[model samples]
Target: MTTTPDITLRSRLTTDCELHLPGDPGYDTARLAWNLAVAQRPAAVALPRTPEEVADVVRAAADAGLRVAPQTTGHGAAALGEQDLDDVVLVKLAALTGATVDPTARTARVLGGTQWQEVVEAAAPYGLTALHGSAPDVGVAGYLLGGGLSFYGRSHGVAVNSVRAAEVVTADGALVRASATENADLFWAVRGGGGNLGVVVALEIDLLPYAEVYAGMLLWDRERAPEVLPAWVEWSRTAPESATTSLRVMSFPPLPELPPFLSGRDLIIIDGAILETDADADAVLAPLRALGPEMDTFARVPAAALTQVHMDPPVPSPAVADHSVLGPLDDEAVATLLAQVGPGTRSGLMFAELRHLGGAFARPAAGGGVLASIAGDYALLCLAMAPTPEAVVAGKAAAFSVVRAMAPWAQASLVPTFAETRVDASRFYGDEEWERLLRIRAEVDPHRVFVANHAL
Candidate 1:
């Protein structure tokens, strides 16, 4: 791979934005990704705080014959790491962050690098909230572009469907607006096409009207997986569209930093949002509650608090994961999953999760993007902490093992958000959708100047 000369890169981008060359003092820090497990060494890294700066950097990079890879928190860096970044300009958007809420319109206009927590907090006072992901620190651009699945998903729809418009800087450095009425095709492609076509600098997304929600978790010892797992799966099958939840068989290493209930323990967790009245939510949760969990935190809380319900690490950490969209889980399928991370099994995984999908999740939204709906019952995700190289190897093997074991019940499709590494991009969309995405990608980025986590 041929890299652009440092002098050429500096000459083009130095006046436009903050540029970090290979040997620059801040290059090492600027190139770090959220997933510490991924080591991405792009030819250079640029920090653009405004749309104009972003456009300048994009044009400069393309003029220098370098491909531009736009990244926010780098949560999905593993997928981008799979490519050759020797000739790529890593555009870190961490400096471009902010959010504005229009309560009257029930929408939020957020900068590309804004985190879910920012948007949640900004809208909380308005008694409104966006369909944010479980992790508060997750970048909005990457998540929505990849068809974000949320606790409100079953009741509403995938987060992308809530998007009204996006301001993107195309490969040619032209900033354009994409929505149902403006740059229509580009808008459709971007909703699920990820950052393959351009650098998304701003997005105006519709917010949920929920001021408060009934959501939380129920935990039981890992020993109860044999019983609790099946019960939750059964309940999920018949659960109303107003409820969305996930079941996880988790193993925690002995660490003093963790809470008593999670540290050095093997447990089963069931958690999510139940969009119903207090009485109605209780009735819907009766069956699972009957199983008698050691801890039940499900109750009515402010919608903003839902971002913390899943207890995702508030800070960046090293992790590796494998995922597959699964159809209805039968007895054999549940049994196979149990074999991998059952009570007595040493799966070496942090957690093996089955996010209950279906409900409105499987139905297409009107005027939605290419990835309007996920055609599966559950999204199976297995993740392992990978703080060390040896651990990364083991974690990958352990994670892939469970995914491979459950392949018989897995669907041919995948949810772009859950995918940890590069896979068949076509699996995320239908044949016609995939073809249309390709055509639009070629038109918007004829030279393939932009490289997204999941390339279209």
Candidate 2:
């Protein structure tokens, strides 16, 4: 049975903001996410312009005996199951895309709805940069909340550590500030915790002093995998904290939308950024250079260009992704991965990646949030196109098999953003951390008024 929205609540929400029901003209468009596979169906959708407006919307939902779930860009929508979103008020904050940088303070105050691309452009002129994700179009709030893993992470730390403050509208319809000093508990809970405590409207984050860097991709045919893949792994063992890199094996189908170099090709690519000079990058990449990759694009580029170095899809596409954080990769683990998704496996996966993890990422901050460091030293992400429900199931199974083969080395906990599929709380937090998260959630949201894509 469909729950009809309370008319009084709907009226209040629509007075200053937008309120769209299932049958409304723009409801479908408002509910669409970056991943085209999941079709979102909420009881109602609201787009609030300001923090006060967001609080009002939450109050309205509370008054109507409904819960609230917020989405900035919906890049990680797979975690929101239909049951969790049912009778939930979906708050889309696309209108709150505002950002200001304090060049002297080396900080940026970004509205929740803002994307990384906006912040990169704004900070570039000042010679400062945020700990942005691989995709320029990814929303700042969602990425930061999930303890973002940035191209700069190996040098700096997880993006959450850079957060100075978060302006949040809590379940009680009260607007509050969360930081090291103010609303301290909420501050601790939100950094690595998913958006379960409340809706974040704005964030104050520390910026890095980086104007340019050496960054790009190197590609090789799959036939060279046996030699090249292991060589990259061995070289990564001695790589410095100044560099961040990942290796990906991809099969791109013929499509007019794809770039000529990538379309209808099966290739292995190494992509990353070295914070220092070109000489430093060349020295670090010397081992791989001996193999002579078919294509190499490494060069000194603006730091903003790091956002697209991984070549993440620039548009919405139908796909499913699975993840696993694993122990250090050895010859055995590398061979196991190849047996499942390599050239002749017919794995059906579009791409499989292994990100080298260590450096600042392995150390805990003085007063870090819930996730101090990922338990393992490397992370694997496998994705496949799923054009239909059946394809989604098959694709997910094939991708998971690769992870299962490496299960012995898999970490017990997952990096929040990496758990793109519908995973339970255990997959993201340790037993103690999980209980602490629940206690904090209950204390702040007694009525459980807010629901995140991945609930604790």
Candidate 3:
């Protein structure tokens, strides 16, 4: 049955939080997602400023027989847009932002809607940092819940492992704390289950000890990809756990706002972090540095600066992407990739990247969540700008073309965070782990009141 939220639901929600019903003046703005490409029209949109207000909205939505989808920044909004959300209430947590760093404990507690940059800035003064994604605007709850992959991943493991606790509002509209010692099962599930079981209101995560680190990027004209790609692949196989890096073949459109080096240019770039002494980092980077990059910015810098090393767009962008985890890139694989986006190819993709994986990334955390570790040696991500509906269609096809061409080198598994579309959720976990997640989802959200981007 189609359910239109009744007036009672609106009254209950608006009492404690801002509620935007369909046709309301603020409805359109309230429903806007970070990725403008996704046109999500939920039954209602709620802006909750506090944990209590979050619970109020969740309870009200559930009482009205409407499902609730919790969204923070909406970087993963593409997957949610794939579903029917007419009966869903999008709880936008944009206003629910704050971060507190406990320097002595080396941990940071961030509100549900907090962005990575907020936490990084908060912890930087204490000479600490968190396992954040390349983009500073990504929300903490969603990233960590999806088994975040960071530049520090090779040495510290996936970002989800750093989560010490999460305060979640369950389907019944009760705010409960989940940690190793409290609600252990929920904690395990929330760590990697996305938002299937509940809406995460706050997260207390362990922070990295480094105040400064050697990190930066290297750039070369696209013509060098053939020479650079294979060499980086060979070097990655022997690279130590302390170093994590990614190489991309990128194409930039001519835009006045962009730097002269990047505007209207096709380039190959390598960037990441090396958690080692200055001498040791130089030694490890010597082989790649030998490739003669046109620009080399590697040096010891404030750890907080690592978030900018990837040069992710400083603002929200309309984009489409496809991802696949890979075992290892052989000569055939390298040649195939070159055929798609290398030198003379006119592939309309923004970039096709290969992120080095293994080391700590491959080993399961000692006491981790369902997504303890990634099984692949590398992750392949292809993306394109999608500024228009036609562009979105073309971008998806462009991104998928590269992914499909590289299938021979791809793995059956996937990194949840890198997956831009909804795929086989089971592929993101082991058979036993998948079964466990399903069981937990049943117990915590039996009625399916909570909708997640990648539902279990």
Candidate 4:
């Protein structure tokens, strides 16, 4: 008698779906994440088409004595780590892609595997927008659970706050509805609580009424960063909440496919979106415009076009990165930050970013999720990619050096989605809140079947 766990699980799963076991034909592709750098070797990868299928897979995994982990696009695979997959069965939701927009209800119902890009396209025709992140390719389920910080974030607050409902498959194979009026406790835990609670199969989320917007990016050469960066900091203080912006310094690789002007160059770029008139947008950006950036693409574009403004790499690639939330940016802190990652520094990071946070983000919602607010005036992120393992090690070290220097002024907490590296869950929540999250986790996931990256 051959005693194989994968074969047993396969026999238990619905026959209509796909399951890739180790050495199976599609196993490699099924386990790949968008980052490409994180090596994921799950015991088995299951593609479930419906919530029923997802629940079946979870229960089957439990029966086979295997932990379950659900991955949509695998954007945060690194944080899941090599150890997390040792005895895990990964549920891939690619086949569950479904998005429906209710223009009358002013909301959208998105399936587990749906990407933000698809939702944005679906809702654009209705003159409405979902609270999506900078990168359109990120999965909707993971983004919302991590307390998503969006371009519209300053104006609308964290994306998780807009979640009206979620359909989840718990560890016991029970399909539960979580909302303010439903399984309310589970609803609060899933929102901004990472994915440890259960597998979210679908979500009903609110949408913004935005037909068009004045939004785009401005770029200045690296040499001018010292002057322009501090100026942006000063300007951000008085900028209206209607406008949201971030400053980033990056060194572009010499890739032929890149634009001639941007290829193989280092530059400082300011990207933002404003829910206002074109003239008002220009007026808000006047001071920074006076700095004479080398490139300016700000204009009145359809809300759907906002996805392209961030210039994120559209395809999967290897990358190493880190993230943090910083206290207020003072003159001295600004100077120190620039000197480390600025033009003349030996930093190997591809991009170093600081997003201005305030306005609606500073206020707390009465019935909001565990992550009520980010607790910092700005959020900082550093990212890098290299071809070789040796280069990756060196590049990451350089990035961390700069991040470490900024630690004194940094907040202990960080958004779950942006928690690229492993840290204690305490860094993401206060002592009491963390304890409450643990109690909730114990209540719903007694066996701890659902494994999530940087999970509680």
Candidate 5:
């Protein structure tokens, strides 16, 4: 007689999700990401197709005495530590990709597995777009779970704020919906809670009636940072909620892939943003543009040109990535940083970005949102390549110093994607929310089935 399989989480996941164990040929490559410093291999990689399948995989992992590591295109591929990674199921939901748009309501249905680029491309046809993180390849699930900020943050709000509903699979291998009406508290936690509760299957988010945006950058010389950095800050204070901006002080690799102006040089970049309107982008950019640029790539482009914001390399590279939120940018500190890591320093640091904050971002989500509580984030992104331990240490020190100098303005939140060491779960969650997450975990995943490689 044929035997029935166990319907618990593990039984459902055993086969439905693609499993790539250590001996698999592409396992090493699959376990890495755009950022090279972070990479790791779990006992197996589970590519789940649906919520039921994901639930099944988790149950199967539990049955097999394995922990689950959730992964999206955006996660650090190599940061897992040896102490906790002996036997784990790396959950990859890349197969659950696709998005549908509703132009009339300015909304779209996003599969938790879909990447930001997919949504950008899908919404273009309807003259509507989802304000997503800088990189198109960043997954929607991680972005939303991490309290997603976007290009349209000034005009709209975090990607989590735009979410109307979610379809999720609880730890028990049960599929359910979380909206205003059902599982309301769980929905609130997911908004800014950083996925501590459960895995989301699909997200229905509100879309903006955005067509073409005055989206592009204003490149300046490193010398201009003294003049431009603070100017951007001053400009931010008076900036209408309509415009969004960011300043980046970075060193370009001496690779042929870079343009002549930006190649082998330390440069400062200003990403100027605004909605699709008759507003003259140049007018807003004039203050920064006035400082002068050794090279400039600024221009009005289609919103789908998402890569331009971070200018993150399309091809993965061997590099180290880390970041911190700046509370403020003092002139002396800015000067010290420019002198140390900018143009002539030849510091081997790839990019240092300063994402402009305030505007709508400063406003807390009214009822609550599911995400790590990120109160204020004046983030500084530092990317570097460390061929030696000494170089890595130096780069880390330099990056930290910058953040330390700017710490006066740091909000209590951190982007988990950038965590290199230590994840204080309490810092990621507010009092009630943090307690609520633990309670949910106890009720749903009593075995502590999920543990993030980078802390909450």
Candidate 6:
């Protein structure tokens, strides 16, 4: 049998908090995150039942001179897994799942640990939605704290840009409410700053009057990509911010439950989003529609149905994603991308998604939020969902090396969330932005109370 430690820390909290020891029943589950790549084992797992319980853990970790490596959900766990983590208390936030929506204000108050699916269902009654990821299972806390990307981001902006307030447990063990009027700088950093600042307990953010959407994807046969993708790129130049768009080159594996035309087929797929305010989205998208598709399923659909935009594999297969933000897609750059990962290549890759940027995504919000510097017109994202590790590595290298190969036109910086394993904060956020974030951390968390490590 194991015994509880005789430390002053655990005895100080007011709420009924539970601690999971090394060999305890829930310890493995508590320490485990969504990333299959991360193998983490914390000294103790603190499952706090209340905000004060959270503060207690923070206070105790500070007093014990231990840094905190917090995990709200596993959506952004890849970045977190690359740390030399030890003596850190894993603050497991699963029990803090409370949410409420104010329909009139178009806002939602979400607990620090809430998942995206919870928010979608809760906001459904109000005919509202907060900009969220395609995966319904992704975590809201982790997603927002790590710079939330969404299907609507091109139209509405990144998820972090919509935040109005955040309830945070700072490194000093104080529960501080950060908003525009209160601790304004910290609010800015947390919008896009990786969780290097503090542990967020709850978030209050704007929601949209969205229930229905003109969404879903159009899959085309592969032999036509050389004919298709280039013209689609030209149309991308004139697209309005109201429509978020992407083109992916995919080869879906043969299997039951997959679309008949898509299954066992190599396809040049064009995925689109037309944020309708009662306009004929099809008319706005006609040029690409004129390019013709072998299979088209574009029309009005439920917001929950928006996941089809990426047609991300519903199953968890081994995967590797390579990314680069593109400045412009002249014929040469576009052709290089198509030939490298597109249909004729068959380069052990699954899908190469080219998302259109610029427009509202590049414009600053009325009040500034998250990352503000990127004015790039496109983001080249390669989703390599291979069956084995070797394929993941080889595919990723070929894909991103092409990105580095195109560095003259690609943006020098990367979205910290999308960057894999090159932990340079400077490349993710420019030196000015990174320095400002560190300054805010110094003011709000002078003791360096949180743990943060990311790849560039």
Q: Give the TM-score comparing model 3 with the true structure, all chains together.
A: 0.98
Candidate order by decreasing lDDT: 1, 3, 4, 2, 6, 5
Off by over 4 Å in 4: 1-7
- In candidate 1, which residue pairs clash? none
Runs of candidate 2 with Cα error greater than 4 angstroms are: 1-8
Tell me the lDDT of model 3 at 33.
Answer: 87
Per-residue lDDT for 38-86 in model 6, tens only?
5566667788877898888888867766667667655456555656455
Number of backbone clashes in candidate 4: 0
Candidate 4 clash pair list: none
Measured over all alpha carbons after superposition, the RMSD of each candidate to the real structure, in angstroms, is 1.1, 1.8, 1.1, 2.3, 4.4, 3.7
Q: How accurate is candidate 3 locally (lDDT)?
A: 0.92
Per-residue error at 225 for model 4, in Å?
A: 0.6
**Model 6: CA > 4 A from native:** 1-16, 277-279, 313-317, 386-392, 395-399, 453-456
Model 4, residue 257: displacement in angstroms? 0.6
TM-score of each: 0.98, 0.96, 0.98, 0.96, 0.88, 0.89
lDDT of each: 0.93, 0.85, 0.92, 0.85, 0.67, 0.73
Whose lDDT is higher: candidate 1's or candidate 6's? Answer: 1
Error of 4 at 254 (Å): 1.1
Clashes of each: 0, 0, 0, 0, 26, 4
Supply the global lDDT for candidate 5.
Answer: 0.67
Which has the better TM-score: candidate 2, or candidate 6?
Answer: 2
Residue 390 Cα positional deviation in candidate 1, in Å, after optimal superposition: 1.0
